[model samples]
Target: MHIRRLAAGLGAAALLLLTAPAAGGAPAVDPVTLDGPGQITDQVGALGSRKPDVEDALRRLDTEHGVQLFVAYVRNFAGRGAQDWADATATKNGLGQNDVLLAVATRDRQYAVSAATDSGFTEDQIREVNATAIEPALRQNDWAGAAIGGADGLGAVLAGDPVPAPAITPGPANPGGDGGAEQFTASDVIIPVVAVGGAGAAALYLFSSRRRKRKDTGGGEPAGWGGDGGAPPVTPLPELDDRAKQLLVETDDAIRTSQEELGFAAAQFGEATAAPFDQAVTSAKEELTRAFRLRQQLDDAYPEDDATRRAMLEEIVHRCTEANKRLDAESASFDQLRQMVTKAPEVLANAEAAAARLPERITAAETALTAMTGEYAESAVTAIAGHPAEARDRLQFATQHLGEARTALDAGDGNTAAVHVRAAEGAVDQAETLAGAVLRREGELREAAAKTAAAIRDTQADLADARGMVTGTRQDESTADLRGRIGRAESVLAEVGREVAAGRYDPLSVLRRVEEADAGLEEALTGAREREDGERRASALLDQALLTARSEVDAARDFITTHRGGIGTRARTRLHEAERHLDQAESLGATDPATALQHAQRADQLGEEARRLAEDDVSGYGGFGGPVPMGGGLNTGMLGGLILGGMLGGGGRRGGGFGGGFGGGFNPGSFGGAGTTGRMGGGGRF
Candidate 1:
């Protein structure tokens, strides 16, 4: 009668529930589908009381942020792993971008949270949420808590908000009582027992027989069975065999070599002066002692059981490995210490010398800035003012750091002193750069102003000579226009001289305007000469101008091509423009000699600008200490304005993310979640 009842139960269970298909077979159940926004399906009824809360969280997330969330619980995954099952389920359901699926294999004791590709959650963030919010609840068998907490945490992360801490329930030390009977629910035992028929029954009978035998012998099951039971016989580690002896010999040789190197480093660098080297030597000595003691222990514990001998050998091997690692680290540290010690005196001297010269350099830079501002009230003088101010500030900073470094050196803290010295040196370099830029700019302005003035004077003299030759000659309408233009050019030249004397003009702009006036005077003079001496003289002047322009253009082109790799995009563009202007000049040289000369001159100027730009790039200063003209008016406010503008204009956007540091011990890349396919997220074990 009992056998018949068992057969009936098996038949009924088989008809109601089928196992998942074997590998290479069709799936036993249809793929899961997410039918609603807040649906939480519990195939195994694991999330018994928590389904409503989980559903509410999912609905809220979807409504607020358009992030879809799905949760599921199943008894088993058949033969499919949790990761594979979750991926297949998500694909079959046509999960859209930013959709997230959390699947739990209750019987398999595994879970996976799969996210769509466009989800904002990063792998690190997802891992943190799971470890902090969901895993704690799962550990205490609170399935409902896991689902609700996980949903809320994920929702918070997706919304760019902080996740709330998980609420944990305290449980007894041991949930299973001390009676030692294996606990099983009806569903857990009956389903598996019925699936395999009498074979399952025979396994249960054998387990019962083993328990009876253990009870009769007064021997509790094993130590890990949650009962006060006798431990199984421990295998004694083996004594030092030939292999162990050989390792010990090698370890001793390594220790001796390390000691020799340490001694040499100490002698060369002065042991009394090298604190790190002394400390490392002490540590290496202590580690060697420990290694020797471990070897001796293994050697003395002879004639032991095979297990005991093996254990002893393993301990010796561990000690030797650790000792070797320590020796290597010590050796490298001592080598660095030696280099630092040898260079300390020279570095200190150089830093002291630089500090001493800071005041003179600062004063010189200030004088240059003052002179620049007095001579030119343009933006270039204002821009140049900022460099001196920055230099002064950096010098002060360097002084402070240098003082600290000296104090540290006096206190015999070489390592700390070295750090301060390096900082001081960096500050000094920046100060020098700033001051140098000011000095260089002032020199360039003076040179450019003088050259432009000279050009204006020479062209004015030439025009006067031409005007004398045409004095009292027969004048036509064209000659009348030429005379009027010459008068205009002279007026502009006087105005430029007045602005320069008042220190209210930009050097480059003044240069440009002066050059324009010179060109106009030359053209007017040329027209007058042509009327006096015919087209032959006019052609001669045009030919001379064109030759000069061609020579300058050729030089500029050669310079640009030679430094092509170092030139920037702006300079390259200017060079191409120069080429275009040159081509135009060539096309018009025969038809309009005067116009062709102007075009060629313009091309020459552009080529010179391009060459200067390329040279600045090659020098690594990016025109910082180069002759590029800055053109704004100068005043006390201008200095501050220039400095502020430079700071803001040079600033660029920076990107970064949060990172965790060591707590109990060293941890690297261990806190983040595992990255999943098609998702910006990761997972971790509970």
Candidate 2:
């Protein structure tokens, strides 16, 4: 499982680090509630008690060591590379420097650790941590151990302790303990060599003319040049050059249209609501600009390489294609937001309802604020001191907008009324948040004070647990960090307890201090387990990809072998290419799963084509002559695993086909939410 890595590695936390922003976008992931300073989202379940232990360790990592670890366990990577998915999650979460994300898509049997470019851990350190702590436990199907190991490993690095060494000692090769490689038959060794040689020879033959025309041949001019040293035909669409130019112009017009639409929409739905659409249009324009630059370079006076021009031309189309895709992804949402202009009356009603609630809400908020002021010290109420004033200002703003809305409605301008309604709604919501904040603050403080008392007890228990893990303690190097932690917790909690009882303090602040002061303990977040006791590892997605490819290839080969007499060159040729690609995949599988996946996918595509061609050839043969009675005892063993298929109608092979990841079927969900103050960088294959 070769995983592509992503970096949140924090609040700038993760996203796919790609030169071209891999066309895939993240899935519509419902937001996870990140309450703790450090945490893990165990979406695959099965962690039980270990989830908290691991989270406590992560909290310790952050509180004590100044590093945050954001962990996620998804069912699978699904629509994007591990790195891309990981990065997107991190970025969406808005994790910052000193924060790192440990994303485990165990169902896919792949993991990626992402950190910001400026994170405390280096690339080399991340690699070390994964090898020594993460992957070994993963390979053993120990999810809890993997998570704990990550915490333990990162903790060691932060404490300036030696990071653990690689834990994967290669096992006895054949289980015979002779230290030799696993046994394979002579044919196993022979087939790939013959396949590679055959494929290479065929490709060389088919591409020879283009290859010869590619560079300056032995002759000073060049062999096989198409007059003005034209690019050798690469794409099947000969009109691609014309198509590229047309797409570029069309996309540019689309971008301009978007900009104009954005202007109109921004007035109704403020800049914040319109920001994503603006970003999409900007990104699309940048891509279009790059395409134009490529086009300009292509038509320049300088002598260009034939391959370079062809590549640039293809790239022009690709750039335009990507630009169009980005725009397309946002079009519906953009259009819907704009359509809100027609819903002005509805919007105004809602805004008016919000305004009506302000008077009682503000009075309740101020009354609540005043009652607390007398009982608690001013320091205790500092957080909400301005909450009432802020609520008042927002109410004033809302009233102003509400008046504008009525005026716009009188003028029969729905768009203007919609704009006023949006502003009034925002102002009212802010006033509500401000009022709610003061009311909620009272409950939060009382809750925090109670929690502070509990935290003290927890700290004491944590110390006992710390001591319990130790035996006949001479406090060796291994236990030194824990020992130091216990000593520090004991000293800090003593002072904290005395101060908390003596005078008023921010209970939330005290809790954070206690968390930092204490040794590791339980995390409070109850994760939403996506699967009830799922498997140790997800069925390997890449393995499934390969299996499907092989099925398609085998089906095609069997059908062709059964009807070789009727099958023409097209079907046989496609089948040969499929076999060749499959062979290449097998050869490369051990070293490169990413590229192996690509070849396997190609094999699947070609095999499908071959099966269709073979079916057509067999069916057309029936029209030419009466069906020959099936031969009874033809030994098909030497023909390489032939099977009875397609009973003269579309059957077995038709039901089974494999296809590509396909033109980035990424429908990205909305990105902003609570606790998501992110600025992290991107990700890639690890």
Candidate 3:
């Protein structure tokens, strides 16, 4: 069949050679010379007898489907990629809105296909034809076969037929049997003539000879030949001058608002209220400066070249956006700091009131400890004695920090005051927990034991459910570690149970261990459950994202078709990229749902951007404006100020205002028992 086709076109082949340039020098071919709106230009001459057939097919398709198809055959793409060459040629030739171009670099063995907005074929159809038909034939060194197969496949798809499989045959073997020139029919002579003229044919012969020599030495695919499809249309730059100017104005306003807030905070709260706010103000100032520089650059850049201008404008937008965000955060921080400064004195009074009652509470704890010691032997009630002693020590520490907090507040150091207050509060909480536990053990031993047992059982049930969720799924190290922790907790619970059964158990001790074990088990169970639920949720999200992405791609494609003239090159390119990403998301959905979601989200974003650009709706800086007033709160420093007065005045035994002389290790189970210690008598701030 191949031989017959080659033989029948002998006459056309002769005419092609008759037009060839005389042998001497093969002049360089300009890509523009061979590219036009509705024509197939064969610059490399690889089409041979098949050129007419491919051209006829394209012409017929255009006439019937309102689509234009252009084919280009080049000897080399120079240093340019196949996709780059195709895009440049398409743009330069002023290809029609409904045109498609198939560019093949025969010597380089690379090809790319590009389509205009109204081109009837979708990207998927183009990719399929390239993969199943054109690429296979090209890989086998059958140029005519690729051209014919690609044309047929594209035409069939346009006509609503499934793409046809490539019909390929081996090229003739080299005559010398030493891998010299491949045997060719008389028709082969005309291919080079049509491509580069007669002189070009001489150059072709020499080029073929060199290829054979290279093949003998180190054989590989032709220099540029590969399976890469062409890139999408280049994104044309939007008209960004007005957009940049608007963003600049908005950015300046944000900066001014931020500066005003900073000045107010410094004046009202003394420059040292909160270190974080101060740092944020400084950083925002720096960012504002950078934004100004970027704006200047944007202004200097000309929008004559759409690509360069768009890139410059995008940078400006990014810088301005970040500046605005930083400024807003700084302003909010200032407001919060101002409120805290205003409330400091009231907070101080409240702390003093609370401190006034601490001494009496300490006395009651001491009485309970003394009773526990009298009822049980010191050795038996050893655990209960330690907690109350530690509570006394923590109380002393809390007292000292409170006094320091007062000094800092008096000096207008709210940030320092707040830090001290937090430390004081933590110590107080620990002391209170220890004292309460000791008291509870002394008064309600039996009840505490029962509650501990119930907690253990509940935690066990939760652990079991968590274990069930991850039974067969692949488990990470964290999950495995959680399982081990749960097992340890169960072991601890069993030990507590054994002690209880033996009738020799210290109720306070047993209760403490049980609580610890329950906490650990509950934590482990929660972690495992969250891990399981997170994966399930991620998979579901990915599925929904993929569906949405597909819908977006379809909408973008439809918009391009309906408004071909209205859409710019950049928008059309973005739509193409959206489709590509959607395809990738679908492929990755099963194996990597998280990654799949990322791809789908990107697709959706690009699709929306394309639609926005096409509609010329790209003028605004869409971001946060000047800081709105968030509700205010008191600063931690004010609370610290209150703690200071209480610390200095509330004297207890041990010579510390509250926490002094409370230092001692308490056994976890020894709380709530009677023991004797020196009567609480410390009365000075530590």
- Kindly report which residue stretches of model 2 are placed more than 4 angstroms away from their true locations once superposed: 1-341, 370-384, 465-472, 521-686
Give each model's whole-structure lDDT.
0.53, 0.56, 0.51
TM-score of 2: 0.30
How does candidate 3 fare on TM-score?
A: 0.25
Write model 3 residue lDDT over 49-117, tens digit each, in one string.
666766777777656654556777665555676666676666555443345667776655567876532
- Model 3, position 334: C-alpha lDDT score: 44
lDDT of 1 by residue, 316-338 (tens): 56666666555544443443453
Model 2 lDDT per residue over 1-686, tens place: 00111111211221222211233322333333334543767655636556676777677766665566778766557656677677666656555444577887654556788765434355677777887787777776666667777777887876668766433333211111111223345664456556555654564454455545654454443323323454574664447667776666456545543564475467557899999998988788678767766765554468577667668779988888888778767764664565444667766876787689898998998898887776555655654555566567657656866787788677765534554554455456546755776787677556667667766776686667667756576867857766777777788888787767767666654654565554132211102112321111111223434554665576566455434435554565566567767887888776665466567767877777877776666545542233322232111221111111111111111011111021111111111111112223222222
TM-score of each: 0.30, 0.30, 0.25
lDDT of 1: 0.53
